[model samples]
Target: MKPFPKFARQALALMIASVPLFPVAQAATAAEWPTKPVRIIVAAPPGGTADILARIFAHELQSPLGQPLIVDNKAGAAGTIGVHGLLSAPRDGYTFLLVQKGIVSEVPQVMKVTYDPFKDLVPLAQLTRQGLILVGKPGLPARNLGELVTYIKANPGKVDYANFGAGMRGHTMGVQFNRLAGVTAGAVSYKGSPPALQDVMGGHVPLMFDGPATSLPFIRSKQLKAFAIAYPKRIPALPDVPTFAELGFPDLKEVSWMALWSAPGVPPAVLARMREATLKVMQSPEVQKKIEDLGMEIGSAATSEELARDARESSERQGKLLRSINFTPD
Candidate 1:
């Protein structure tokens, strides 16, 4: 048989080279997936929104993934600990971190963290968003945002507000309130919202900025008076209560969000799967009602690419805000 022509030889070589790459790519894609239990690291202790959402998501993902979904709470250091834990895990899509908006956006700006929020992690999806409610003891004079602002102005440093921690979302809101409303208030920190809320309910602290999960039950029982929600629009759970914008402080609107992220370098296929699983869980009626009942609004489902972009934008904005305010971690 005559030897192959030059063009045919080149074509044969190209086909041989392509054959190995196909299986290599297939193997990489297959190995990129989770073959064991996947852990979702929550940045707060049990009973908190991050933890609760993680558990719900784990349950929803288990059946589809054919693997157990575990939640590991590494609460401390303003969520950096949990983030560190997630970062330390393998990047093979078996580990994820459940984080709030503040942890990704604000905490890094104020604190020195081991991992860069944007560079070290890949965003999966934003699961929920909720407005914080400003609440006070039932007998306090403030009934709405206006009343609260006026009272704080009159009282100045005398109006004390308890928060989960110094640099937490609640405390950040307090700083914004003081800056915008031109009123000074004392910030008392607690280990978490439950204890801080306890202080508020017992009249030890007259005011507090609390999440709906912690504040809603009290508001319903008439123990705590709901002032105004820190959101652009009023939430249906507290429809009667006005938003801060309605009360003339549009800049005070802040919506807390919970999101899922994986360590950077997780394969695109794995990340896509995670995003799909998270959106599916959040869209379910049962999960929707549970989140809504907790006083949070379900977030718009986002693709992995969209979530990654949001994380970057939020981090940049938060860095600017913190630097402008000269905020430093404690």
Candidate 2:
């Protein structure tokens, strides 16, 4: 993976920062909206990245809406189960998905789903962006990123990497890793993270790309090895682990975004209030502290158009990567 040239990186930063912070929409006062509790659909299990961050944001977002924000875990089928649940809810702005962008960007490229992300849900705000960590079993011969590449190439398809599902982030990362790292490790797909991590800890699968919240505890416990983070910058939570760009893979500097969106048919004013309250929560001191504790940085994309653009870009990139690997899953 090649890192972007300095000028390209600078140009991208400038372009993103230049976008206006808000979209032009008629906003209702928060007081007039949310006459009842709001439910945030967390599309993954209770402890996964989506679930953890959604809960935290819900905790902070409740203050502004003057209503309870419930983090509902409707986890299954690569997050579409919860998303399907949203189709039945009245599009009154009281319900929306609080999920990772990959659920929209990557899942469709890999499996059949009941709904279209672009049609069924409306984009609202992007909360935080962070990198994924490539962790290996401690007993593996490779001690670092370079050695891990060398070892995987030497062993060819003998080394196994875990993916939570066929088209999920872990699977996308694994595909990119195989192409960028120039290795051939067989993929071991699981129903979810627990079974995958169980195998990683048991040494059945030697490598995986995981979020910091779930894998950090095992890494610190010496149950798994940290190879590299999937971003351009090193994270404070895993300061000892170098990013892919730091180790010479410049093209692998993709980060994951967590976004919130109202179900389709919500009134524009309701959507505006939801977006306003979310942005307010992101800027709060308590929320910032909690985000730092989770080892993430606040993200931009305050407007729905901006967020939709980012997700589409991500999906395009993921599609290209999948093509490079000749991936086709039924």
Candidate 3:
């Protein structure tokens, strides 16, 4: 080859030197994608099971992301508002949503959602799946599901049930249960289970369909009376409470659940890293015990495809459940 000019040789050497370095810097940036604080949006008010579960995952996630995790509470509109907030944020992996599957699966059916949940939010991991309990105020005229149904039949719209959000698990279960029981009762929506259950406990609301963990304290204290669990079997925490399946409602065996999600189009490498870090956190004995103590079953084995499939199926099923009760948002 012809000899290169002096300036051309210097320029070629400089280009060769830096070509290798840019990728190194890019790789470093990729590895440390979350150099700033990460936010995990909880779609309900604080002091609810979703909020509690989000905090647990957030605490464990800090070490994985190498950045402190912030829990952002955006409670309203039966969780639709929070979903809007999540989608409005950039699709960067740093912003995640820690919410119940019901919001994605159950909420969209009753009314409308601005974005397609499955398409807009990429499923990361399923954290916990557990049964919700049906509890009534301490002085509701009925002691069991049968009596409660009879009371509702007799008293129709005079009684009300509390739910954290419209079209969520508690809402769907309550509406479904009433349909199967052949009764009519009104529902009151709240920002979270804590507030809704509080109304039930204070006798402001007649009954509530809520998470086992959120209602456990009140059930233990006798502020709220546990009528029946929405699981296939009874829980050790409340051995006396009969399950809906045991009480002749076989279709009521579904469990309420929560999952972690990232905004759409997260880099594949970052997605894999997130999956690995989450699985690590989930596999820890301490985290498992902590979740179990909260009356939730760990569901870390679920894959993203499975999560998405389940969401679609469950949304249709819940839509039917709501329709059976003639439920339509006003």
Each model's TM-score?
A: 0.86, 0.86, 0.82
Reference-based lDDT, each prediction: 0.81, 0.82, 0.81
Pick the lDDT winner: 2
Per-residue lDDT of 1-330 in model 2, one digit per residue for the tens?
A: 999999999999998976653342224333377889999888888777778789888888878888999889998777788888787898777888887887778888888887886777667898998888899888999888998898888887699889777766788788777877788888888887778888999988898887776788898889999988888798877789998988988777788888887777787778877888788889888878878678787777468877777788998988887787688956
Question: Which digits, one per residue and each the tens of the lDDT, describe model 1 over residues 27-73?
Answer: 68655566788888998989877887788889988877788999999
Model 1 scores what on Cα lDDT?
Answer: 0.81
lDDT of 2 at 171: 82
**lDDT tens digits by residue: candidate 3, 144-262:** 88888889899878988898777667777877787788877788888677788778888899988888888888788888888888886787677889999898898887876788887
For candidate 3, what is the lDDT?
0.81
Better candidate by lDDT, 1 or 2: 2
Once fitted onto the true fold, the runs of candidate 2 whose alpha carbons sit more than 4 angstroms away are 1-31
For model 3, name the residue pairs that clash: none
Runs with alpha carbons beyond 4 Å of true place in candidate 3: 1-29, 32-34, 141-143, 146-160, 186-192
RMSD to the true structure for each prediction, in A, is 4.4, 15.1, 3.8
List candidate 1 segments past 4 Å from native: 1-32, 316-325
